[model samples]
Target: MTAPEPAEPPAAEPGVTAAEPAAAGPDSAARPGAEPAEPTDADAASHSAALPGADLDGADLDGADLDGADLDGAEPAGALPTERAAAGVPGKRGRRRVAPAPEPAPVLDDAELRGALEAILLVVDEPVSELTLAQVLEQPAERIGPALDRIAAGYTAAGHGFELRRAAGGWRLYTRPEYATYVERFVLDGQSVRLTQAALETLAVIAYKQPVTRSRISAIRGVNCDGVIRTLVSRGLVEECGTEADSGAFLYRTTTLFLEKLGLNSVADLPPLAPFLPDDVEELADATR
Candidate 1:
């Protein structure tokens, strides 16, 4: 029998090229019928790995019309909350930024120190400690202490109407005792100088019997003195001392303001009450009997 020659492939169109068949494996091509080999890691990855334009997060982009992601390696405008935390937000970069401390004030000369201390003293409502003054003025504690002493000494030497005094563990400005009459007249502004009689009595009781309970004070006075005691306390004349051991009542005592008002060094300076009492002790005893 004569052998027939194989027919050639059909001609491609003018602009259209013929599609090429996929190259089969060498063994598969050699064998008449063979199953194809399984896809490799590289082949599986190529399916996802080389998408037209893909991001590190595995999200893709087809064109400019693609939605909700930055083309460059930047955070998208609409990011998930979990992603926003690390999305280059200013001042929230997962690290603390501590502001630098303010610089200390320049050291002051003697005249400058005195002026500064006087300025602070004028504005102060209560006694300010030396440590506080040193911190505020940025001077050494030793220097501040001696400077304060010198300032006090200068006031005393000059016989100024006001003196720098240390009391209650701190320094304060005070009107000298001799000049207090003028200061009182100025501050009173037509108000009376005397404390109320009840207040005076409560104060006297507290001064004489220091750390006495309110009940004991009432017992001695034969009246309810809660209001008077409160008034004395409000006036800074009396303050709470330790509570009574047995009764557990808050005990009252005189204050620094009280001593200052009376110009006394301590409660011991309070005059003896017996000397000021009425002289007819025998008649009073006879009447009581």
Candidate 2:
């Protein structure tokens, strides 16, 4: 039996330093006097590896390199504006600056504005919201708000008998405190030290919404009614019922005298206030301070 010997290596071409593989394709095969082939992605990556400490972090490892040729000249997806700038990529601008919100235009001339606000205030029993007023006047809320303030300030500056003040989440006209005494005296003339309008209003709230706290009454009436509550208690029309379960605030309710004074047999006999109240009365009560 004879052993076979390994074949000898193939002879190199005259100009080539090494012999090429037998099955090499045209692009892959070595040639005589051929210019250096353009580098492919793998070749470029190998070339980049030889340059140690050179930053290629931002470079595309695939066919799409920093030049972004493979991207059809599009900016790299998800690149921020500043990043695109650093990469020397051109960027289209964003949408034009949104036009500055138009200023609240004048809803009415000064005279008409004052007249309109005053007319509304004079007739309103309860405080009215600026939003409500704005809707009525067909004006923006911003316009209505400032006009109300200016009207309030002007009235104060002129020392008017009545004043425009904000309470119960709204604006209202009230007799100036300095004149409240005179107003009470006139409104109470010849009466048996009777309830003033405020006392009456407070009593009515307790009658309608008994088992409520003093704060609740004030919230509904849009004024601090602590004194009025005390007056009603002293007059035997209201009494402390119990504490509110959650807040532990002292709750008040109408006394038997309340029914007698109103000529009602029971609370259910009291007149319904639906026609005079807003639909969102519960929300109103909650929102008001």
Best by lDDT: 1
Q: What does candidate 2's lDDT look like per residue over 95-119, in tens digits?
A: 2224478787565876897798899
RMSD of each: 10.6, 17.5
The whole-model C-alpha lDDT of candidate 1 against the native structure comes to 0.79
Deviation of model 1 at 13, angstroms: 41
Candidate 1, residues 1-289, lDDT tens digits: the string is: 9999899988766755343335756565344443345666667577768776644454444453534434345555667656655654323333334558999778899999999999999998767789999989889888888888999999999988888877655788888889878888899988986888988888898899998999989987879999999988888889998888897899999998887666565678779999876899769768756
Taking all chains together, the TM-score of candidate 2 against the true structure is: 0.34
Q: Which 10 consecutive residues of model 1 have the lowest summed lDDT?
A: 88-97
Candidate 1 residue 86 Cα shift, in angstroms, is 16
lDDT of each: 0.79, 0.76
The TM-scores, one per candidate, come to 0.52, 0.34
